[model samples]
Target: MTIESSRAEISRFRSAAVAGTLTFDPDAARRCADLYEEQAEHLAQLRQALENASETEGFGGFVSAQQLQAGFAHKARDAAELLDRYIEAAYRMKEAFLLSAGLYDEADAAAAAALRAVDTRVRG
Candidate 1:
């Protein structure tokens, strides 16, 4: 998903969670985690490509070539850094989804146990 769509989804989740109305789906969470991981991998590949391009031989003695090379190097570095940040963010999102799934599972188990205890007392 695009960044805008992710942001919108996150906002919706935050609102629902705060209101105690969020519905947790383990399968959906797993799928989201997988997508984020895929995104991170793609970003990593792009970053590697950028790194390779940045290492290209510098220009010869010509003044314009030298200036252009310097500018390109600077911009390339900035782009690589931005891609690195995006990769990190994507991994973090993947982790968050996985954690949410585990937490939801735990919460459901706890609630079930609590209900079982109540039912035993009522039926005893």
Candidate 2:
């Protein structure tokens, strides 16, 4: 595929990643994960295709098969890096949700302590 097509695919994957994280619904989150997985696979395929093309036609001035393979390897590495960032973002969002829920626990603890303090004051 052309560079334009590759960029478009990357954009689509990035959008899906963002959408999945922004959504609060469990179903949507699952969809997002699925999309991310699909995107990663596509990226891998694209990288291989580019490597093959470069080998056959001396891709953009690549002098040898080794150079073509290296280019694809770099592309694959970039895709993996992007995937890691997306996963990390998802994890952080989940952590934030848990922390929000924990606030109620903190509130209950504080209330219980206040009650104990009042009881001791009255008894003393």
Candidate 3:
């Protein structure tokens, strides 16, 4: 798939990740799958581009398949890390919502204390 299409898929995945459902939403799972697919597609395109470039006489010596693969692997690792961050943020949001719902007084107290600490630090 093309970069644009991969980007569109990732956008959809992000939307799904943020959209909640009643039960078994599968949004997170879908997001994970979409992310994986996007990474794979991106790697494939990179590999193809590298291969094409290597076939050019002048540019052939510029890069090797191993180097291209390593670059793709690095990008894929970055993508995975990004996905982990997104998932972590989503879970944190969910946890905060649940905490606020079930322990409003405690959450409020904590927030107030945190604000006071920040204010003191800023003033000091």
Candidate 4:
């Protein structure tokens, strides 16, 4: 995706968050975190599998095949790097979800406490 597109999506998400149009559900956030963790693990496994399958041992007799395999290996390494970045992003997303859940829950508790204090003063 383009940088502009990513910025736009981030802006939209921020706007929604600021407007409270998106409700924060701790349970949902936790579920999203779990999903992200799973995705990261899957990507890691996929990257390892790709590396294993890209080995040049089977094509030793053919110089052309070895060259092709070398090219494939290079591309595979690039792909593995990209996958590693994606896995890192997934973990970051998971952390963000968990942190937001904790922050929002704390805010809610604080608000409830303030309201209860107001209630007691009003009764007095």
Candidate 5:
């Protein structure tokens, strides 16, 4: 991936993320799964971007101080990986939310199940 391609992928990912919305009991599984898969792909793209960044070291060496600062591939890669981990956790939260909905037949029971799912997911 070149710098141009990385920018394109990042733009596409941002568009997709912005277009997504969370629904409580409606199409939760499919919606969450779709987003999870997209985020996973985004992670792969980010990795490729980092690889491209590393290969662009020669270009960075001839650039100005500001460009050198901006060319810090390792930092960008670390931050992106960390963000992906958080995104992965959010997908799990969505899954837990759906599980809560499915585990109970009554509204009150669903509330209890939801609480348990959220607590367990958040704490552990």
Candidate 6:
């Protein structure tokens, strides 16, 4: 893909984030976790595809096999690195959802404790 295409995808994701379309609430944390796993697998596959592939068309005087392999490695590295950042963002969002859930639980417990105290005092 060209640089413009890459930028467009990045812009799309950023816009989604701005729209809260990527929201990961506590109830959907499980789904987000699954997505993170899938993304990890996808990235691994991309890396493996490049790492395991043999040189191509280096037979042409235009480029050597080593240069072609290096080019492939460079592209793979860039793709993998970009994907890793996105996956990490997803992971962070999942963690945020989990943390928010925990905070809610703590707040609920606190409210219950306060209610119990009020009840006890009022009944005495």
Task: Output the number of the lDDT-best candidate.
Answer: 1
Q: TM-score per candidate, in order?
A: 0.62, 0.35, 0.34, 0.62, 0.38, 0.44
lDDT (C-alpha) at residue 121 in model 6: 32
Better of 2 and 5 by TM-score: 5
C-alpha lDDT (0 to 100) for residue 42 of candidate 6: 70
**Each model's Cα RMSD:** 15.4, 19.4, 14.4, 15.6, 12.3, 17.7
Please count the clashing residue pairs in each candidate, in the order shown. Answer: 0, 0, 0, 0, 0, 0
Q: List, residue by residue over 7-47, the lDDT tens digit for candidate 1.
A: 46655654554355654477886788778778877987887
- Tell me the tens digit of each residue's lDDT in model 2 across 1-124: 7434644654554444344542334445445444544554454455456444544443565467668767776765555444333333333333333223333343244334334433533442
Regions of candidate 5 where Cα sits further than 4 Å from its true position: 1-27, 59-71, 101-124
Error of 1 at 92 (Å): 1.5
lDDT of candidate 3 over 61-106, digit per residue (tens)? 4558556656665665555444333333333333233232343443
Worst 10 residues of 6 by lDDT: 106-115
lDDT score, candidate 4, position 59:
68
Deviation in angstroms for 65 in model 5? 9.4
Clashing pairs in 1: none
Which regions in candidate 6 have their CA more than 4 angstroms from the true location? 1-26, 54-63, 103-124
Q: How far does residue 49 in candidate 5 sit from its true spot (Å)?
A: 1.7
Q: Write the per-residue lDDT of candidate 4 for residues 1-124, one digit (tens) a residue.
A: 9434643654564355546565457888778767877887798798788778666477676889889889998888777766665665555555555545564553344334334433433542
| Candidate order (TM-score) | 1, 4, 6, 5, 2, 3
**TM-score for model 4?**
0.62
Give the per-residue lDDT of model 5 (tens digit) for 22-119. 22454654465456546645654775576566444454455585476565765765655554444444344334434433422332332353344345
Least well predicted 10-residue stretch by lDDT in candidate 5: 102-111
